[model samples]
Target: MDISDKATEREEQDRDIALHQRKPEGPAATGQCLYCEDPLPPGKRWCCTACRDDWEFIQK
Candidate 1:
């Protein structure tokens, strides 16, 4: 393809990557893990990284 077309394709790819990496909005923490309902400290959504990753996976 032409240089301009290639540039446009790259831009679209970058946009796609950014969108995929963006986190989806979730409910506010309520003193529990969003995934496992385990107790959590204030301002925390997940009990651990594994829980967070699983939660995000299920969200998709």
Candidate 2:
């Protein structure tokens, strides 16, 4: 209810936001695209089923 409480709450919220922002975006993957032949995780994980299957086929 007082200014100190409000400031503390704001500080906590800011810390939470910073923590989330610093967290890793998502899981990592190691693979390659077939058609484009680009890297995997960096390429949004193949884009589609076709791309994925194509990658598998190419691997063979």
Candidate 3:
């Protein structure tokens, strides 16, 4: 494609990415695992990565 067409395509791609991006929901630090309710320190959302993944999966 020509320079103008390529520029338009890039703009469209950027807009698509911006539209799909999402901000984190809920509290930043709940002091417990969101999925399993396991105890955790402050500033932690999940006890482990697995719990975090499961929480997100269930949310979807």
Best candidate, TM-score: 1
Off by over 4 Å in 1: 1-24
Candidate 2 lDDT (Cα, 0 to 1): 0.66
Report the lDDT tens digits of candidate 1 across residue range 14-48: 99999966668878878999999999999788999
Candidate 1 local distance difference test against the native: 0.91
Question: In terms of TM-score, how similar is model 3 to the real structure?
Answer: 0.54
For all predicted structures, in order, the TM-scores are 0.56, 0.38, 0.54
How far out, in Å, is residue 38 in model 1? 0.7
- Which residue pairs clash within candidate 1? none
Q: Is candidate 1 or 2 superior in lDDT? A: 1
Which runs of model 2 end up more than 4 angstroms from their true locations? 24-60
lDDT of 3: 0.83
Minimum summed lDDT over a 10-residue window in model 3 is located at: 20-29
Q: lDDT of each structure?
A: 0.91, 0.66, 0.83
Clashing pairs in 2: none
**Candidates 2 and 3 compared by lDDT, better number:** 3
